[model samples]
Structures are given as C-alpha cells and as structure tokens.
Target: MQVLRWDGGGPMLATRDSSTLTVLIGTFAVLWLLWAIKKQRKAAVHPLPPGPRGLPIVGYLPFVGTELHTKFHQLCGIYGPIYKVWLGNKLSIVISSPSLVKEVVRDQDAIFSNRDTNIVGRTITYGGADIALSLNCPNWKMLRKIFVREMLSPTNLDITLALRREEVRKTIRNVYDKKGTHIDLGDLAFITVMNAIMNMLWGGTLRGEEGAKFGAEFKHIFAELVMILGKPNVSDLFPALARFDLQGIRRKAKRISETIDRVLDYAIDKQIKSLAKAKEEGTTKTEQKDFLQVLLELSEQDDGAPSMIMTQIKALVFLS
Candidate 1:
C-alpha cells in the first residue's frame, strides 16, 4: 500500500470478497421473499396465533432444550392456549387448552385427519402403508377396521389372554430360578413384554432365541431410526436435495429397514408355510387367531379387491 505496487493479489481479493458478499445478500433476500410468501398464504387461509420468532435457517427447534415440558409451559404463559412454533421447515401448532383440542379433533376432524410425515417416517412405514403413518383413505379405513374389529376386539383380547398369562408365568419361573442370585429386573421385564407382544402378533412365529434376537435387533434399529428422524437433515429441509442424501440419513435408514424387511419375510413365510401344512393335514385350526393370521386371511380373501397384501402385512408386523 505504501508504494501502491501493481501486485495482482489485492484487486483479485477485493473482487472475490465483493462477489461473496453479493451472493450472500442475494440468498438472504430470496429466503426472505419465500418466507414472506408463505406467511401470506397461511394468513390468507387463517391467521396463525403468535409465538417467538426464530433464526433464519433453523427455528425454535434448537432452543427447545431438554426440558421440553418446561419450555412448553413458558410458551403457554406467553402465547396463551394456542401458538405455532417452527421446527426448522416444519410448522407445528401447539394447542394447550382442552376446548381448542376438542374443537380441532371433534369439530374439524376431517380437515385434520391427515398428518405430515418426514422422510424417515415414510421410508420405515413402507410409503405410508402401515396403520401408524397411512393416509386417511379407503385402504387406511380398511386397515383400521380390521385392526380394531378383528385383532383388538374384546373377543380377540380374551382369546390372547392365555398368551399373556404364559409370558408372565415364564418370567415368574425365571425369577424363581434366579431367586438366590442377582437378577437383572430390566432385562427380565423387557423379555416378558416382548414375548407377550410376539404371541399376540403371531403366536409362536418368533419364540425363544429367535424372538429375543429379533426384538433386540428391532429395538436397536428403531431407536437409531427415531434419532435420525428427529435430527435435522439437510435433505428433509430442502426436498430437492434429498436425492443427494448429503447427510447419509437416507442410506442408514434404508440399510436398517432392509434388515427389518428380511426378518418380516422369514416370519411371514414361516407362518404361511405352517398354515398351508395345517390345511394339507386337515388339522382343525386354532380357534384363537393371532394378528398375523387375521391379516393373512384378509389378504387371501377374493371378494371385492384384496383388502391387504404382503407389503401391508410386513408393515403391520413391523409396527407390532
């Protein structure tokens, strides 16, 4: 600078900085415009209640903190019964008052029937075929009807009571066997619950070591899946960038999902083969039907379009 030498670096550095500043300014302007448009559209439909505003990219999600209930309590004090919080790109409306909840659930049930699901939710639910994530459509209606009217009806519950009793007795026996020694209460309880649930799902389709291994695998995978789903993924925020999977969330989800799918395949195939053998031998089928048997029967029904399919069956098993 003292000599004002004609070294090429100074002017080029200034030019690069100028270009970077322009790009950042342009990006901010575009973001603001899009946000403004979205606000306008939401206002046009119905003006949302007020809440704390957040940063540019991430919203209130970062500040939600570990004590979510406490944060919610604070927000309720400030924003009253109803308020909206932006979770990254997702807009979540929180209703604190019971009356407002009733108004939304009972009065406007149809409008609120379908809920938004993220990429991991869709991937794990097999594109929303399962009851947990399926859209409110004819298929969903059918699935719900079958689930409630057949699998969870009072009659089915009574029929499956024995299975529950058996699992409880198994736990009791194990505890009795380990009475003199130190026993892991948590492991004991978990295995008992898993056994009971599997019995209700498909009777003995998974039992002993198979049930234990499958439950362990499923539990670990599902925990990871939930974490990935809850974490902020660039792909989820910007749908266009999903194909790139820059964060690799999708790849991890797919790998775990395939492992689950394989387990489901084995269970379904084993059950089908068992049913076929029972039919071939002309043995009287068990009067108490597990959820899987009901699903298989529904899948086989030829009247009025197939109500369920193998994919749907797999999803139901996974959900169970």
Candidate 2:
C-alpha cells in the first residue's frame, strides 16, 4: 500500500512521533469535517440515495465476495433499489426497481447512454472504436446506422435470405442423416449459429465437416479469449503499471487480434477480387455483400467526419 502524507495546517507537537500522530489526526478530522459539510449541502440540494459506509482507500471490495448476486439482493433490501457501492476507484450505482431503471435508461438515456470502457476493453476493441464500446457520438451513430440500415435493412436481408436458409437446411439434413448417432446438440447449434454470423459478416460459410472443425476451433479459442478478457489484471487496476502487462493478458490479446486480422485480411481480399470481377462483367454475381464491403465502401467516402479505419472494421468483424 502506498502511504500518502498531507501537511496538516495545525499546531505542531513536540517530539517527531507526537508530531506525526498529530498531523494524522488533524488530517482525518479536517477531511471528515469537509465531507460532512459537503454531504449536508448536497442533501439540501437533492435527497441522496442511501448506502453502507466504506473504509478509506479499499472501499467495499474487502467485504465483497464471489456471491455478489446474493449480496446485491441483501443490500437492496437494506438500502432500497438505488444505492451506491464503491469498487476500488470506481463508484457503481445499482437500480433494482423497474421505474427507476426506466428513468435512467429510457427517460434520460442520453445522460447515461455510454457504458464505461475499461483498460482490457480498450485493448480488445483496438483503442475502443468498436460499435459496442465506443462513446455515444456521431461516429457511434454512424456505425450503428451502417450496421442496421445497410447491413440489416430489408433489401439486404432479402438478398441474404437464401444463404441463411441454406445453412439451416444443411443443419436439419445433417441431423436427419445422423439419426441415432451420439451427438452434442449444443455444439451443433453453436456451429450453425456461428456459420450464420460468419456468413453475414464476411460472406463466407463453413459446411459439413469443415464447418464442424472450424466451429470447434473457434469455440475453444473464443472461450479462452473471453476468459482472459474477464480475468482481473493488476495492470488494468493500476494504470501506472499498465505497460508491464504483468499477467500476460495484453500479450494474449495481441496474439488473438493478429489471428483475427489475418482471417479478415483474407476475407477482404477475396471480396475485393470478386467485386472487381463483377464490375468488369457488368453484372451481380451473388447475394448482398457482407458488412466488410459496406464498411470499406463507407471508408472510401471522404466525409466531414473521420473515415472508418481498419482497426474499427476488424473490431466490428470480431464482434460479429
């Protein structure tokens, strides 16, 4: 623990030990006085929510446990729906009641629209430009519009309907052909779902044994990636030590990101070549192009706002 000293503006004591004790005592009293006055003034301005008292520096973390869900209910019963809890340097407010939740989410969405982005999230999202992690702004709105209006519009869905139908049909046929063979329904469903998302993201589809093999690889790799993302890293908690990457979380993240980039590069190259051929032939060859193509096209346009970059494109692709 780092010990911070304050030069208390109070009467000095005789001995060194006595002076130190006096300074500490004076500092605590002054801080407590200021906090009390501020809280009183704030209460006068607007009624504050109730919560348990916390110790200095550590906040409520030392008392929390793995069973946070249960603890949340107990705390709610005591402090009501809207209460605050400090986790390290962060202050978290929980809202359990539907009415208050609505006030925050629906009534005043703009005030609380953006979710907090952490250090690990920034690394995973390539500086946090991804649609999911980005702050609420025109850039985020643009990405959402491209995703919803361009990629998921009625025209685009109609074009890709056949591809989705094809994958589902294949899955059904495989199930029928296998009959009584021992199978993992969860994995089968996972692969089918992954294939559908992959198709939508990059206009690629893995099928039969190939689909199963790719899906298995992805399941293991992505599970590990997710675990690393969720793992507590000392580096993230202490930004001063962030460069060390002490837990190797950032290192693993870089490796995973490289793999994803390589895959996206290959897919992007194939799409470009196909698009070029179609342009030359003066015809359309396949269904609506994937989100990558849409993004690439948008990036080519030099608008007032900053053009989308490859990192952001990869972030979106990784999410899909």
Best by TM-score: 1
Q: How many residue pairs clash per model?
A: 0, 0
Q: Can you write out model 1's per-residue Cα lDDT over 129-246, one digit (the tens) per residue?
A: 8988888888888888878887788987887887788889988998898888998889788778877887778665666788678767777777788789777777776677889999
lDDT of 2 by residue, 120-142 (tens): 67777788878888888998998
Cα miss at 302, model 1 (Å)? Answer: 2.5
Q: After superposition, how far is residue 78 of candidate 2 from its true place, in Å?
A: 1.1
The residue pairs in collision within model 1 are: none
Listed in order, each prediction's TM-score against the native is 0.78, 0.76
- Number of residue pairs clashing in candidate 2, backbone atoms closer than 3 angstroms, sequence gap of 3 or more or interchain: 0
